[model samples]
Target chain A: MAEPTPSLAPARPPTGPRVWNNPRARAIIYQVLVLGGVIGAAAYLIDNTLTNLAERSIRSGFSFIWHEAGFAISEALIDYQPNHSYVRAFIAGLLNTLKVGLLGIVLVTILGIIIGIARLSTNWLVARLASVYVETFRNVPLLLQLYLWYSLLTEMLPGGRDALSLFTAFYLNKSGLMYPVPVYDGIHPFMIVAFLIGCVGAYAWGRYATRRHEATGVPTPRFWPSVGFVLGLPLVVWLIGGAPTAIDVPQMERFRFVGGWHVSIEFIALLLGLVVYTGAFVAETVRAGILSVSRGQTEAALSLGLRRGLVLRLVLLPQALRVIMPPLTSQYLNLMKNSSLAVAIGYPDLVAVANTTLNQTGQAIEAIAVIMAVYLTISLAISGFMNWYNKRVALVER
Target chain B: MINLAERRAASGPVIQMAGVNKWYGEFHVLKNINLEVRSGERVVVCGPSGSGKSTMIRCINRLEEHQKGRIVVDGIELIADLKQIDAVRREIGMVFQHFNLFPHMTVLENLTLAPMWVRNTPRKEAEDAAMAYLERVKIPEQAHKFPGQLSGGQQQRVAIARSLCMKPKIMLFDEPTSALDPEMIKEVLDVMIELAQGGMTMICVTHEMGFARTVADSMVFMDGGEIVEKAPPTEFFKNPKSERTKLFLSQILH
Candidate 1:
């Protein structure tokens, strides 16, 4: 109702950080001050770094990226030689970290879901067990949990030829696990291509099925389509001898895993610890999300004759996910940051590698920059995904 | 509020209760309650807070369990058998005072929920049924809007719409308009009146005596978990029987 107000009138304080008098001007000044502080600090540090570098008889630049990395990795997913450049070594480490991160995210999410649903179950034993798990894990220090998991594995795992062998294919030993690797020998660049195509088709088919079910009560045979893409595509390639590539399943041998790649105990310990500790936190968030859904919603669903299972899957989960996802994203970001604790286990994550490079090369400024850039990229990706999911499931009822 | 009924209808009762008792541990909430409601009847229950007016209707839906006596709704006995209770619940719809509309759904979705999910009606059929009910409530235009976006009255009406979507034979409203703004209260009352006129059996827990007088065939007054009086709207308003009912009527009317 209050219109025709003059813009030159005294600025409301909520207009955000302002100039001494002008709100916009005040915001500008505040921003510039922050920028100036950061730049000034960076400049001073850079000057100090350059002076130190000159005095220490060293240079700072990407020239080091090309120098041979003589250090050997205990486990490498790709072809690697000590003769490779430092950049190649860093790439190998980065890929390894991604591999661990991806697996950890998947396992923790599954574990979190199971525990959360268990917490709300009507069965007395199940509920009590879930509650106990949540209370125990949530209260313990995560770093301590990591150390416990490390020791538990080291002490329990079999040693040498006495190692636990599952399916006669995978070996669990004191050092770590050795499993058959699927190694492709030739131009089956088409495996990656077919796999990507199969994934896209599976996603599309699922969406189409959902749409079809919503439009018509006719249920589509969606499971077969997904199974076909996931299982059949790989089979087709294998049957055709992969047209260009052939795979081999490695076996254990004396003093070595002769046929497949070996996963170091350090990597397993880091991933296992990270997943369990973070999964417990994620479980709490999931439980809270489920709790936030009012009892009235469930009652209403029940009144409508919706069965328990459908009510949970169709009605409750969509709404609960909206509440769960925001906190869940924070847990994921925390897990990624906490993964930096890999230094404790001698795993070379981005931060760990950067920390070592800083100490060895005396290029502290560059090392810190690399750490910041890598983390910032990771944080941004997680944040973007969370925002997208938030938009997708936000309560339309509101 | 509108009062036209002068006497309780003379008929066999559709709902019968005897020696009904309920307690929340040591608190004897509903005690020795006895009542009857007939088919095609509209009854208004009124009392002070903690009088258990809401609990009585909830017991009909098995939303709250009574520890003693028995309640028979449309010939189905309310008992320990959960399946029977659910079957009876599907036949009766209850609207809440808080307008507990699902905040994650649109008004249309709210109205269609019970029909499609419970009744196993197809989406299109449920949507059509919902539209009919929404039209009855005079908020069909707002079908796509989320419940939170609506005013209290609108939300209550949508809740009523949601209950009606099940095509329930009986309706129980727990203070349907209590939370609405005064101006919006009439819109909901009007819809209730239309439903009554159409012979959809209703038991409303409300303080709107004016509404009770107009739409209700009889008014049941409760106090300390017992029915104090049951009379037609005209006699109930003009000359309430019991001393407690008179006192309550005085305070509420004033």
Candidate 2:
């Protein structure tokens, strides 16, 4: 009675070219009309701009990229002398744009994960704190948050020589926070190479260890190996004349602090605005994903004699991630694109740099074209990576 | 319904219930019920819908948690604490009418999952035990395929095999053939009949009178959440003791 005569024969998979000549030809027609409209509008705008410039006896071209950028950037990635060409200034501003974008993404992901888990906590206080964090940040506009953070930070920091001091020479001020910058010679580059090698080696070993644990139920040794490479290699490099080459503590003693790495108020404002606002939305998405998994699944995992942490890590999270990831990827993409709001704070991201370049050169077409291409490329790359990851974790059988 | 187990009789008692009562917000489902089943005994429970027959069976494993009752299966009593209920559930295998097999897992994995996870059985040993059970249920070849690929009859057989892999002292059938098509029902019954002949203790809730006649040593009739009558199958059918039981018998038997 108990014997199960299961079918070994796999059903033939469905096959076909399932699109394009289909009944949804209206979609194609609609897309064509939209494309036509965009092209028509762009041409009209371009014609109007050139006609106006000619009437005003102004030349329309990119000869301005070679002209000096007279304005001083409040904060810049590469050293930008006022004597540098506008094109060079644009490049520096573009790098700063990415710096804020990258830093914001990292902070939001880490904070989002922590807050998301906290929202699911059984402890009343932990869940409440997470709820408060999400609600407070999400209800406010991102631009307002940027203004608030920038203003509050500047107001708290000391002006001139009264900069707030930490441990030794690090100084916090209205202009920027000044942290130690390593002063070094040629050997410093080798130490950096060693540090990079150590990081890569440690990560590769960690991945290998994870695979071994999964395959054989034995955790591969990781701590000693990681420490030896990440810490020991750098130490050895330092002993070989890299120590003085790599080490330089920041020193501050006067009205204008000197000898340190500085972060501009604009950069801080932009990064803070993006992270707190985006992180709030991310928290809600994660909470929804966790709640979507049925309570019965948790009970079943417990009944299977799995430990509490193992139940969450293996049984609950695997299912929750399947539900969470598609939407989470979209949020991350939204955050990256939304960083263009850096212009509102006078932070010269691609948009701001391109705007100034267009004003000086009267080359509206070229400047806007560059802006569109850069944003489009960034958006497409994010989408492609997300799609790949989605396929990896998605449920195989419905 | 009532039965005394310790007469030191021919077959040993595998399950016993006494003074069982269940109420859900003022509606009593099972009322003052008592029963015991000897080893290898096959008891058929017949009742109209909403008769608490399911509730009574569910109480044996503390699934429904009877409001006031004492149910001891394979010697472990269902108590307020969960450990007692979990312990009782391990020894009492159950097959639902819906089959309730894990659809995501392969047939063999479904059979092995509980043993490997709950019983702490090694993977190899669990798979071996699962394979043996799959063979007993006549579905070893389908072990690698998901439950979705199997026909209704095959899934039921897999469900039966999954329970057997637990090696319970007794098996409970909660209308196992009710959800099957006419042709498929016969296959599941044939498997159950085979189990009954092999001396497995069983309590089946069913509308299949032919099966009841063939396998049930005794029969119990429940109505309106109460057991109204019970007797040995031959006597119970030919000369039932209650007017309500006679009416239930005629409606189902005819």
Candidate 3:
């Protein structure tokens, strides 16, 4: 038999019409036209707005950001006075927003996972309760829930003078929650350092235990020992420092409580509303993610003599996480944005502070732009992190 | 290898099921199944679809609960006790039609997971055992690859190796080759033949009559959730006494 020669010659390109009539050329032209239209529209809007501002004799610039903000904020994490600049007010509002957002994300995740697992519980009552929670919270609007919480906190609680007391150290009233705080002492910083060291020690111990278990067949006790290292070390340090027993507890004064740390009812209401509402959606996401894993995976693991808990931790969760991450990221972003509704309840989040600044300075455009930029940055950061995590958990396949 | 007859005589029945009955909701799936499988014995269960063959073996490991019956595996009674179920499961390995290999893990990891976690074997020991099994199955080079990266035949062989890593006394196969292509079926059957020749007690539910003839010491024909006939493969093939058995054999064989 004769060997067939391989064809190595390159095929000739299609001899078609001129560049103007070519398909690729038309595609490029169409894309350029669309791009130009979008840019032209944006430039027109900006020019029109600037011309209108000048004609109305309205000063439009970001210089107003440095001017004095002669307004009282309801709450502030950092020091802020009416004499402070608008920049300081904006920072306070941003901090408030971040405080609620970060805490809400953590609490909602924990609650969502618990409720999600509970929804699948064989016990009828627990499953029913979880479903009810998801349905009720997710069905109602978030703003309404915030309003309801705010009203309940402000109207139902007793007056500051007759605040409800818990163990004579914490006070709850319409004014806010007042809790005891430790008095500053030189030993306190040392105690914190000791606590940090204990944390590092616990982490190192956990790693070592895992390595030892893998190297040797014998397993070591991990949970309790790590706990002892973290908490026991702090306790030892406290004892060694002759633990200062001086704590400033709240006391009823002429009008309100004095001393101790105070938490505003607005902040509490905002956090409660955000967490409860977002937690319901997160629960559904969790349930769906878990259900996405096939029953065969569970049966295979069980057949291998692994316990149900081990099957869930090792096999089910790793697969379920891939399905859960994308939706969970959007849920987090939604929670952050929905936090803007805090303005309705007077929590003074970014939107609320920006609203005040715009009303005072007549720089609605700049204020709104700043608000948009901040939200855009937060949303992108969250999505970027979730994407990275999703990739890590994704399955490898041909 | 030890003589099969001597090995069988040395040990009593490893799996015993008497008056086993099961139901799925309102439907009766298995009704009064009574069987005994001695050590080093290979029982091939062949039947029409929905004949309760899969359900019967699933009951041996307590994967499917029997509503009313006594199933004692290795002297451990199958009951609501979790410890007992886990104990019996450790001695029994099961392979499914879909291969059910954990896609998230490599072939080596899948084989090593149960031994390292349940048996508390060290990582090095588990990997060594896994590599040996992979070599026995003739796919040692694919150890680091994921299950999804392998062919159907290779995946099935890996699944078999995974079961063997646990060093179980008995292995259950439910349609192990039914899901594979015609070309891939022989590779899986060859592995099973090798395993059978090694004196492993196996209960395989399959439609591959040639494999049954080659390896199965006993043949069981089930119809309508009951074993219609049980006999030696030579006797069962040459002269099926029951009408249902004759009909099933003719349908499958021709």
- Among residues 3 or more apart in sequence or in different chains, the pairs in candidate 3 whose N, CA or C atoms overlap within 3 Å are none
What is the per-residue lDDT of model 3 for residues B1-254, given as tens digits with 9 covering 90 to 100?
A: 45877887899999999999999999888888999999989999999999999999999998899999899998999999999999999999999999999999999999989998899899999999999999999999999999999999999999999999999999999999999999999999999999999989999999999999999999998988888888999999999999999899899898
- Least well predicted 10-residue stretch by lDDT in candidate 3 chain A: A213-222
How do all the candidates rank in terms of lDDT, highest first?
3, 1, 2
Q: What is the TM-score of chain B alone in each candidate?
A: 0.94, 0.94, 0.98
What stretches of model 2 exceed 4 Å from their correct place? A1-67, A120-136, A155-252, A256-265, A299-304, B1-254
Model 1 has a DockQ score of 0.37
Please give the distance, in angstroms, between residue A105's alpha carbon in candidate 1 and its true position after superposition.
1.2
lDDT of 3 by residue, A205-313 (tens): 9899878878886666678988988888878888888978899998888987888999889989999999999999999999999999999999999999999988998
Task: Please list the residue runs of candidate 1 whose C-alpha ends up more than 4 Å from where it truly belongs after superposition.
Answer: A1-37, A120-132, A165-171, A179-261, A355-360, B1-28, B32-35, B65-86, B120-125, B226-231, B234-247
Give lDDT tens digits, candidate 1, residues A203-258. 99999976675566454568789989966776676567635433454566686666
**Quick one: best TM-score, which candidate?**
3
Candidate 2: give the clashing pairs. A1-B191, A2-B137, A3-B137, A3-B138, A4-B137, A4-B139, A5-B139
Candidate with top lDDT is: 3
* Consecutive 10-residue window with the lowest summed lDDT within model 1 chain B: B1-10
Please give the distance, in angstroms, between residue A378's alpha carbon in candidate 2 and its true position after superposition.
1.6
Q: Candidate 2 lDDT, tens digit per residue, B117-213?
A: 5575666777888898888878899999987889899999998998887787788888899889898998899999989887788899999999999
Between 1 and 2, whose DockQ is larger? 1
Q: Which tens-of-lDDT digit does each residue in A304-373 have in candidate 2? A: 3344565576556766777788888888788888888888878778888888777767677778877788
